[model samples]
Target chain A: MFKNVAVVGATGAVGQIVRRLLEERNFPAEKFRFLASARSAGTKLTFKGEEHTIEELTKDCFAGSDLVIASTPDDIAQEYLPSAVEAGCKVIDESGYWRMKEGVALVIPEVNPQDALDAKGIIASPNCSTTQMVLALKPLHDAAKVKRVIVSTYQATSGAGVQGTADLFDGSKAFLSGEKYEYKAFTHPIAFNCIPQIGGEKADGYTSEELKMLYETRKILGDDSILVNPTAVRVPVANCHSESITVETERPISPQEARELFEAFPGIQVIDDLPNSAYPLPSTCDGSDLVYIGRIRKDISNPNGLSFWCVSDNLRKGAATNAVQIGELLAKNL
Target chain B: MFKNVAVVGATGAVGQIVRRLLEERNFPAEKFRFLASARSAGTKLTFKGEEHTIEELTKDCFAGSDLVIASTPDDIAQEYLPSAVEAGCKVIDESGYWRMKEGVALVIPEVNPQDALDAKGIIASPNCSTTQMVLALKPLHDAAKVKRVIVSTYQATSGAGVQGTADLFDGSKAFLSGEKYEYKAFTHPIAFNCIPQIGGEKADGYTSEELKMLYETRKILGDDSILVNPTAVRVPVANCHSESITVETERPISPQEARELFEAFPGIQVIDDLPNSAYPLPSTCDGSDLVYIGRIRKDISNPNGLSFWCVSDNLRKGAATNAVQIGELLAKNL
Candidate 1:
């Protein structure tokens, strides 16, 4: 009745989140293996009331596992996950390594479910920022095909991994006490400031995070023609990732129609009323699985343009919850 | 050898900064009067080694004063400052109430000194955000006429005044402990998140801060034909404000030429170097008066578009320093 499961990079933020989602959803697994690098191995992690030791993430770690969730860094996920496929294990990859692959399906289950079927032993989860953007955009995109997306993100420190969160707290202390901050996780200080450049800088002046929104959205939506311009920024927020998005649609739609469409979506919440101050705030959306959408209105500058604010728990909907949903889809459809 | 000076709202954030600037620059004032409301009268403050007793601001407070700097709230500045003008004091108002007035000149001394002379006894300082923006844009607008501007700001807590900064700290503590945050200065928690709306919402969906950028740029640049659209966000930063500005110019200008123009301008430092990660950060410009400009590049999307990042100490260059510079110009010329 249960499938054998394995988790790669079991010690990471995303990996721990993946484990939490699996436990919370009561995903039936015959056996669970926690795999990490040799250096990270042998640590005891409690999952679903059982304490299991982390094993070295060698090629053999995926030998008998029916499903493998790789929440590791991109390079390791890319290099090692193909071995899992060779061992006949399906992979729900939470890294961008396999996202643009020729055969692998880049899936956001709510947005694109049918593509999950054509998965050649692997499914790619979109970037944390992209996942939330698409979730917010899909409802509106369905009402009217989004032609161009101009987005500016106020992302959290956690997206840079656990050490990034620590850097914010530590850096702020160092700054307040008149001491120099030795940068570790981020390229600069994360506390008491906002960094406009996120991810590595591209030669074309777009950051890697910005390009991921463009590339991942195109791949997931199955629409390469859609234009996306993104500027990802690292704010001091801890969990939720917020975006100020302006979209140009193929046809004009009123704010009422837009609100209706958003409210109709499964994982979207419409919080657009300004008079009552009932807009979505990240502080309110912390730990929530649903993608919170608000500030819906027509962009007065352009004929068919719409502007809105979007927020979601990056660790949940953006990472673990999405991966778990992919597993649920795999359990039913695969 | 010195003029008698009066400071309205002498206990507020901008008021404190203006006082510090006056002392730092050794502003030539033989007599100084600190004026506040009836409730705040009798409070004493020290400036330039002299203690000044705060006086209740009444109809006659402006009498015998040569120059009065009004840093009060908008409605108060509007209603009270006209009385100051009637009482024969030449006023430099730092409130938005008189900034866009028909005859009142919005002055940022480094960029538009000639505009200051046109003031009809009430010289209005530009909005703090607008002050830094036009300072960076003027050098570019001079070389190439800017037709349009699209900016997204990562503003700081200081922009909302002292209470705003306190709210951020208190809200952050409440947020981490899982308690209901008391929203004082903002409608939501400002600890780890960004708010897309700043300065109250306007009729057309743009915030008051956004509209100020639009109108003030047109006034300061002396060009009503310029089209400006801005989205202002209050990020979790403490001191400086950063803006991602995209400009559409009438003519094409290379990134290098734009860099040279900015470098030649006073109170601007160009820090564009992508390969080495040497761009302006708020920490780098925290205590400085310079408008730190970086990441100057050509916009690949539009036909004569240029993109750059502008960072400045909102309290200094954006408020106090600019006011002091205007006072210097008034002293020299008027």
Candidate 2:
């Protein structure tokens, strides 16, 4: 176990969840540190029945900490994480910054625990949307060698940040009351509508978020030949991210076989029962660490295709739980 | 011009829009009559600056009307539409019952106006979800024969009828106030939630709505060979249905070629400019008759695949407007 484990961005949305998860899961460490930006420094927070003051994050802050798990914006991770790695701390990052960088391990603990054990630098967790999808695809990929994926995501506002949920609730109240609301988290009013664009434009008209689904899956699954076409849209749901995923494999996997594969896989729960209105929904899957799969059926368009719906709490399985799980995996290996 | 045009289900959601569209478009008819079920039989509705009493819809109501445009539940259409056909009136149905009937001609005016013109019996308007997608696919199919389509829909509550929107608004209000809400139109909560199921279970685990996207597209486009895989989902939007659609054609169609094709297609408007965060959104596409297309890009999964985002007013182009356009088409031919 690490002598001193530091939680970066401890007061932010995913940060709070990470703190709660680490506490709830009883993370093994000799010492715990909570660090945030200067603005949140000196604030009081409770962890494991004790009150602790938040510390301001800096280049020299990682001196004593042996393990660092960070959840910050891209630029913040880019600037501060390397310092932690150089300071001899084993780092796991939640930001998108280091995931695609060469030698920076992108680990979903259940999908690839060995990668975390072998990582030399900051290990990165996949994006909220990408994490749930890749976790669902992992079993299918192992069974049938998934060749292509067509996914359209119904992402929750929480993926944007805490302010995204604030915008959704407040904007919805304003819409109901016929009042104008100035949204802070999204350019479009996300109260009762769908925003087709998630991240900024990347090459070939794909958003940065969409490309991550493609590139991250390739990296995590360690299969560069697998093709992915993703359209990530933000829906009004407050927590879990859901996906309508169709997978084409080297061989066709029937719905029954897919159900078995999903049930046997770790971190996945199958909730498919269409005739009775049973399926994995955002409302049902919120706050859960497990990825839920439902609506499993044959992809009528292709002979080698199978389709299903996937949902997982973006903040948990997609972000915090994933990061904490990585931390636990490392602790086990240590 | 018809001596008398009868509008059916004139008090419901799509019925109200059909009334407004007829007035706005100044449909050529010497006289107009409104018909509804016995519950709303004597209700007063104004059309073209004239107050008309709603007549009870019955087997004998087709007597003086030379043309009939209907937007009613499937059972009502199943029972009454054949009678209108027998009464020597040109009938247009917005219900799903007659759409897949052997003699029925499923039509989208922009895509298949000739089918509407050639129909000897009730002309059927496609499902709201199917209409928007097929309209978007028509141009691509024309340019390069579309072989398979995979579409996931972000359908709005209004497509569930007036009560659906009522549930959304009232449920959202209740959710904000921390009160319990009993949903009327959906099996699950639709406020700030996404329901993966749209219609009742049909064969092969596909919902009736999903099968419509497949069967209806085949009928409307007059191609039984075109393969379609659809996942229809209901979102919190009050108006307009959006879809993430990927099409694999017989030949490769570049994004530039697809955009040009979409721009030239009737009833399609291109709004793609990702760098500027410009794309088709449900909030922006509401209350429009034309289908909006954006996020046009290459489907990285397939060599011959092209993908796009489509949004259209489900009440207008999906139902009322398409039915009214069919009436206009038959009138012009006469």
Candidate 3:
């Protein structure tokens, strides 16, 4: 198994989690390196109670590393990915930049582990909201073959990075204290508010996040014909992204059958009993790796539609955990 | 001119806003009576710097009132609506309790001002999120004749009640300060996350909030086969609700034409200049009565699909301003 691993952008929230999860999973690490921008370089991060200094990342940062996991911005990934591949190290990207690129495998290990084996030294992780959603949808898709997907995402601030999460806190404090507001990370003050647009709006009235859901799902599932309509919004939450998914399948599957398939998935936990106030919640899955799902039933208005509620810690299944899982798959295969 | 008005549940968020908006708009309120639950009776609320004592909302609270605005919970409204009606007062309901009842006219002034004249003493306000969305969609619907609507709402906590907004603040504070979590206002920790299912799940997997959007929109728009698929979500925002709306019109309408229609509407503002960052933002519209709209464009994949983003203060256009607007309509009709 490959052992030497380097984490690019290791100083940010997602990068921190990637480092922590690596240690927690006891992945065989021969040489561990933490990489970040120049400002974050020389900073020490404690993993499993051991302190490791972060190094400045450059085009040649991936040298001497068997595997590199990048949890950085899209611009940075687009800039440095070629260098990592040239260095002969396998790379797993956590940004949306490489997700749609041809021949760059988009891998969600729980759903499509086989795709990881075809990676030409670079694998792409999907948008955090898309990751948790597809994980929950895969089981249903396997059972009934989802034909149409209409999803509305309630995303957390952490999905935007540390600055976004911090802005929520600062902006909220400003609102509560009755002070002048300042906008930084978000277009509006997100404390006790919702922004309907998550990513920048494209020409077609869809935000980039919405388009990412459409394109990434098609690429990951290996089917372009799957109809997807997504509306992505940023909520004040810090960690979890929840989706209200309305799906139509090729074949009619009862809610009971869908529930059985979800319960059988390795990374999925069905918390759908509503009578006793049982359903997946953000707090319940805050630090966990599983996608918490509930509220599964038939969409009565449509012939074969099914509606379900899904929640997952965006920083985990949406980012770090999925990246780490990809590394594990790479180790097993290569 | 509504010179005499009684506000039931006057101490609640919506009730308070209704009172202030009446004063701000100078609605010729010669006398105003504030009514609240027995627990909150005798409390004082200041409007335009004048202190008004809240009275216990007995059945006789609406006596001699020209207009009575009911902003209480569904059960409270059901218990007291008859009293308001028997007192010879024209009633405007903020809650959805009477909205879809056999003869109660659901009215949005911009969309269905004529529906107000048909009211038999009671004019019902549409649900908050539904009201804002329909207000934004109405002009477009009239010009293009919308055949189907798919909406996913990013609703604020204030839509639930005062306690709901408070719970978000308290819970977010708790989680941020590293305390154990508990959920009182919502089934999930909404401080740093999003919950897909709001207002509980119905037997058909659609949430109660979702159903309200579907049914209320059809009723207000005077169309039943409009085919609305709604998924309502509760976000951490305090007072504004945002919606991503996709409308399939009977015929194709260009994005430019759609923008012209939205801008021509009395209460709708078009903020579609994406490059300049000029879009409807919740924080900016926190105290405004207008429904701010932006991100308008055609759905590339669907020839007839037109998509847009809409935001409004749920407390205003969604609830209070709508109720007060209905009160204005009632007085004109009376």
Per-residue alpha-carbon lDDT of model 3 for A202-285, expressed as tens digits?
Answer: 646677888889888888888888888787877777778888787888998788898999999989999977655677767678
* Highest-TM-score candidate: 2
How should the candidates be ordered by lDDT, best one leading?
Answer: 2, 1, 3
**Candidate 1 lDDT, A1-334, residue by residue in tens:** 2378888887898888888888888886777889999998998999989899999998777877889888988999878999999999888999878888889999999999888867777888999999999988887778889887778788988888899888877776666557888869888788787787887787577778888999899998888878777778788887789888878799987778888888888888877766566677777888888998877777755668787889999988999889888888888864
Segments in model 3 whose C-alpha atoms lie over 4 Å from true places: A37-63, A180-183, B1-4, B28-56, B60-63, B178-184
Candidate 2 chain B: worst-modelled 10 consecutive residues by lDDT: B42-51
lDDT of 1: 0.83
Model 3: TM-score for chain B: 0.96
lDDT of 3 by residue, B128-197 (tens): 8888888977887888788877777777777778888888778767766678667677876667656666
Summing lDDT over every window of 10 consecutive residues in candidate 1 chain A, give the lowest-scoring window. Answer: A169-178
Models ranked on TM-score: 2, 1, 3
True contacts kept of each: 0.36, 0.90, 0.50
**lDDT, residue B120, model 1:** 71
- Name the TM-score of candidate 2: 0.99
C-alpha lDDT values of all predictions: 0.83, 0.94, 0.82
